[model samples]
Target: MFTKILIANRGEIACRVARTARRLGIKTVAVYSTADAKAEHVKACDEAYWIGEAPAAESYLHGDKILAIAKLSGAQAIHPGYGFLSENAGFAESCKAAGVVFIGPPTQAIIAMGLKSESKRLMTEAKVPLVPGYHGADQAIDLLREQSQTIGYPQLIKASAGGGGKGMRVVKSFDEFDAALASAKREAISSFGNDAVLIERYLQKPRHVELQVFADTLGNVVHVFERDCSVQRRHQKVIEEAPAPQMTPELRHAMGQAAINAAKAIGYVGAGTVEFLLDQSGEFFFMEMNTRLQVEHPVTEMISGQDLVEWQLRVANGEPLPLTQEQLKINGHAFEARVYAETPERDFLPSTGRVSTLIAPETNDFVRIDTGIRQGDEVSMFYDPMIAKLIVWGQDRTQALQRLQEALSKYYIGGLNTNLEFLGNLARSADFAAGDVHTGFIEQHMAELFPEPSTPPDEVFAAALWCELDHTQARASKAQRQTLDPCSPWAIADAWRMNQASIDPFEFQVGEALYSIQGMQRNGTYYLKLATGEKPLSGERIQGDEWQIVLGQKTLRIKIIQSGNTWLVFWNNKVWHLNLHDPVHEADDQGVHGGGLTAPMAGTVLDVMVKVGDQVKAGDALMVMVAMKMEHTIAAPKEGIVQEIYFQVGDQVKDGDTLLSLE
Candidate 1:
């Protein structure tokens, strides 16, 4: 075993690797950009080194700097965790040249699988089932057009160099192929420094399943079953589960064997994932092979009872495989939900702010949370918005789903909006519960999932009301303490008093209607209760100036403050900044325009289409913005004349910064 290792990454993955290294008594060094100086990973490791600026290209992607740091720190090996330079064959070879071990597959294996076009050819030779499409390198527009025609319409255009939905497009018709092709090429060049593309058949209803394969230097390989990642949005996985709900013994064997063949064909070593697209007809096609650890590897870890990071370290040290393929057995169902700093209500646009308050779920038997942030931490605009990954395991899929829902309910985060509620909705969705999932699941249910003015359950509303009252009373008591003043003459001594009856009732609108509640002064505190007929439905607990409330399955610690004449209630990763002008009679304003082209998420602008006076249609591509390796085309909201452009190519933008405007 190596005595020291350097982690060439940051955020949660770096911290995660450090944890395993510590367990094995290996000292770890962390390499970080300026933006991550105080990041969790830096503090988690034994020592740290500054690399470069905040942008990945300036820091994490600077392989020369990373290698120098490794040599200086006396690190015997370097673990490239998942992103940045993880799959770069050149970086791996360079490490070997410097006499530093790379804790991943050999450079030859990475080179073989790094490019999609080349990798598909090798897989075909290995006899793995591949989707029927175009994988040729002839990038001539005319040649690509001819190839698309042969491959059939409704095909997918994918980047040859990288994955993660960047530089990928689905062209449903021949008329749209050219434009889609051009847009995809631009994004590909910007993101991966390669504009090469390949066309593939787009399965309209496909489930994404991937096999986890590990190999050691001695040619020993084993399959760790599969993970179903069909629940996705915009080609990015949202939820993943291991031991696919409906997988049969025969089908598992077939896919597992195919995955092993794919690995052996490349002489692969360490941890890699073989991804496949399973059609509705139960046939699976090899999509691509990720040459690094996957983001959702936790699900596989739960069911297989294996630590993949540790396996990577052992393989790098020339150790033989510990177990054979037959020794691996699937244990139970595990589900992982990615909690992001985005608002599902606002079309899942990335939201950023300091996490004002946070409380994770209490530890339980079947629940696990992997996170690297805390209260007052800023969800910066520099990188991915994934706050944490929440994982839960149970004996079956239904039980696992139930546990996930409960875990989400108990999770509390405040300051910015999150997708917790959206995740909960999906967990309880009938189609999802029935194991009917595909890549297009979110698009099919988009309307139902993103309805305007969504309302929480009535019980949830009652709890919010009770929490508001307790917050108000706490403020009053705090003010009294600061002044050392006597109690108000109007204060009630014990029970509800008539003198306090004159206090105005609080009213708020949830969804389409209005509701009212009143607080009763008792026991040196004010209590607000929702009465259903003669029975009280809920209450709040307030001691000193802190408040906590339980509503249905969710518990929240909230603060209520007055802004002008309106009241704002902050809880659970969001601030309900209500402009409380009227408790009833508000308009359902649909077309009221919000000014400017604010970035839907934080990202670097890849290209700007307009030049301050270009005529465009309602849905024309205004610009392409790249965030977390995914490219999203910012479109025009309406047909109009361009007034100004606030950004250009290569500029980093925040979530709500105006990119362009219309006159």
Candidate 2:
């Protein structure tokens, strides 16, 4: 076993690796960038070392610097968790040359499976089922177009050297072939530094099921069942479950064997994921293999009772497989939902800000929370925006789903936009509960999951009334504290006079729906008059942002956060972003309107399609900004001539900064 290992990663995966190292009594070293000096992963390790700036090119991807740090820290091995240098064949070879064990597949295995086109070729030779596609090495544009036509409509153009939807495009017709190919190559080169691509038959209704396979130095390879990652958005997984709902024993065996064949074909060692796309006819095709630990490995761990990281350590130390294939058993059904700081309503755009409030549900043997951030952590723009992963388990899928929904309700994140509401909706959706999932699940079932904003629920209005009253009391107390004569009401600068019949009028907006309520205090309870009727509401802050409230005769626990004039009411596994409809403030702020197009978030200007004196119509693309790896295009609001271009290409602009103004 490794006496010490340095984790060449950060965030949740880094912390996850440290956890297993601690259990095995192995000292762990962590490397951090300037932005992550105070990150949770640093504290999770036994020692820390500084690398470079926040950019990955300057820090995590510098394998030479990392190997040097491992040598200095006396780390016997290096664990490159998931991204960055995890799948870099050059890095693995460098580790071997440095005499430091790399706790992953050998360079041979990584090189064999690094390219999708190359891997598909090997899978073909290994007799693993493969989809009909073109995997040739011809990079000519004319030749690629010919191949696309040969593959027929609805074909997939995938980056040969990448995953994560970075350099992929789906063409539905021949007319769209040229543009799609160019776009795919552009994104492919930008993401992976390789413009080569392959064409494949894009199955309309396919499930993304991947088998977790392991290999040791003794040439012993075994499969750890499979995980169904069919629920996805933007071509990335959102929800994953193990043992795949309704998986037959025969199909499982066949897929498992095929996965093992691929692993052996590549001379694989350590942990690797063999992805397969199962069609509606019960036939499966080979997808690319991930050469490192996966982001959703927790689901496999929960069901198999295996610590995959520990397995990597043991395998690196030349130990044999921990358990034989027959000894492995599926204990229960498990589900993992990724919690990201993103706005699902806005095309899942990444949200950046400080996480002022992060209240997660309590975890137990059946529920787990894997996170590397505490409260007050900044969701930086320099890396992935995933906050934490919520994993839950039960004896069956039904029970596990019930646990998942309940756990999601108890999570509350404040100070930035998040997809908590979206996750809750997806988990509770009718189609999702019925196991009708695929890569296009979100798009097909979006109507039910992404319902239009409606009038505020009655409880939300009641919570709003409570918030206003609480704010009033807080203001009064603060005024009294700042007064010279605390004993005198006049010195307090408060004209506070209250009576039970005093009707406190309040109005707010949930989305565009307007709502108003009258709150009156009587006895120990407060009655609120909304559109429905008068209801008794009472609540008090129990601790932190939590509130214990009673509506009528029912008791509930919720959290309320106030930012500016907006109040987020966390109740019933949903978030209600309430904006107080103050007409005075609205009039004061709506004094001027302009034809200026601004940056939606802080990002670099990737392209400026229009310049000064350029005539454009509404909806014409003006500027493109890239932030958090997602691109947002600024469009013209109305027909006008571009009078001034404030920022050009390569300029970094903050959120809401005008990129160009129109006349």
Candidate 3:
């Protein structure tokens, strides 16, 4: 085995590779950008080096700079962990020329399967089942229109070199073909530097299933079963599982053989995935092949008891396959849920901030957490916003899924919005539990997934007040210790006296609503009064950061932490942040301008869909902005005439900056 290897990626994948390398007694080297100076991945490696600035183009994607660092650090190999430069054919070839092993498929294999057009032609020759589509090289608009008609209505226009849902469009009719084609080409060129596209048939309610295949230098290839990635949003996988819930033995055997054949046809080596779209009629069609490790490989690992990264390393060292196809068998069912720092209520918009507090669920032989972040880590806008991957295993699918729900409820994060609640809801939904999943799962159950917010119970509000009172007493006790006065009045709880009853009113704001609460202490007993009702309550600190509260006949144990002016309260698997309202200071609100359209997050303007004086209707696309490698289109709020455009293509804008105005 090689002594040391350089990881050419960041975030969880980098840390994941280092873990396997260390287990095999191989030294690991990590590379980071300016934004990741204190990143978890950097600290997980044996040695680290700074490559360039935060932008991927200047750092992670710079093949030459990474190669130079590999040579300087005396690394014998480089592991491209799933993104950035992982699938770059040119980078793989350069590594070979430099006498450093690239722990992935050969350069020729990458070129063969890198482009959609070329890969389809290759698969057709290999006798692999393919969907009916046009994979020709002609890029003329009229020619594409002709092909679209032949393919019938409701076709898909996919970029020849695209992934992650970028450079893709769905056309439901001929009338929408022209504009959709133009937009797809523009996005393809901007994202992948390839404007070429292919037309394919769009199947309804298809399940996305993929087989994990591996090859070695000795021309040996084997299959590692399959993973069902049907639950998706915006064409990206959100939940994945191994040994598909409804899969039959016959279908699994056929798919496994086809995947292995696809890999061998191109002389593939190392780890790769062959994706397929399973139709409702039990028929499957080839979609595409990923030339590197997949984002959801953990599900496959959990079921097969194999370390794919370790396999990649062994194969790159010219070793033969570790286990043959006959020896590999599925041990148990597994599920993986991708936890991201995003807001589901706002269409899953990505969020960025310093993680003020993070507490992951307890791990054991059955539950695992693959993450690169800890408390105080910053979720930046320079890369993907995936917080972690939660994986669970059990003797059966039902048990495994049940464990998954339990783990998600225990996961906690603060200082930024997240989709933890949304994920928990989906996991517990009746449809999901029954395994009625597909690519349109989220859209199908939108109402249940994003249910109307219910009014919080009085206990929650009382708990928030008790947390504040504890904080006040702790601060006062510290002050009393320094003054050498054991009987300092400041040490007593506020509004607590030996005389008559005293009611101390406190105000709090949650979201846009203000709540009024009064706490009364009389004869060593406490009562809380709100607009809704009154409740007798008592609270006592239990150890650190935990409290026991009694409301009438019910008792609850809650976790509370105060950071700045926000009080984070955890109860019954839910987290809430309530800001204490200060009467001394009031917020200044600027008058709302009806015609102003602003950017919701920091990003670069990719296109201005409208011009000054252009008439538009409500919900019309006005501009396109790219942030954290994802594209979002800003739309008009009402029908109006465009009066001004403040930013153009390539202009960097901050959050809440006005992009345009209408009249």
How close is every model to the real structure, measured as TM-score?
0.89, 0.93, 0.94
lDDT of each residue in 1-663, candidate 3, tens digit only:
999999999999999999999999999999999999999999999999999999898999999999999999999999999879998999999999999999999999999888999999889888889989999989998999999999997889998987777788889999999989988888888778899999999988889999999999999999899999999876778989998979999999999998988998899999999999999999999999999999999989999999999999999999999999999999889999998887888777777888987878889989988899888999887788898999999899999998998888778788787888888888888988888888888999999999876555677788888777767768877776777556777554467556656877778777666788988876677888887677788899897777898876779988776767977677654666678998678776532376898887677899998899999999999999887777788999899999999999999887678999999
Q: Number of backbone collisions per candidate, in order?
A: 2, 0, 0
lDDT by candidate, in order shown: 0.81, 0.88, 0.88
lDDT of 1 by residue, 232-342 (tens): 875778999998878888988899999999999999999999999988888999999999999999999888888888888888999987778888778889999998888
Better of 1 and 3 by lDDT: 3
Cα miss at 408, model 2 (Å)?
Answer: 1.2
Preferred candidate (TM-score higher): 1 or 3: 3
lDDT of 2 by residue, 1-663 (tens): 788999999999999999999999999999999999999999999999999998788998899999999999999999999888999999999999999999999998888888898999999999999999999888899899899999998999998988877778899999989868877887778677889999999999799999999999999999999999999887889999998987999999999999999999999999999999999999999999999999999999999999999899999999999999999999989999999988898788888899887778899999999999898988887788899999999998999999999999878788788888899999999888988888999999888778987676777777777877788778888888888887895754332355436567888877767777788766655688877778888888899877877788777777777766888787766767898898766633221158677666777787889878999998887887777766666778789999989898889887668778899
526, model 3: CA deviation in Å?
2.1
Off by over 4 Å in 2: 474-501, 521-526, 539-548, 553-568, 579-593, 610-622, 632-642
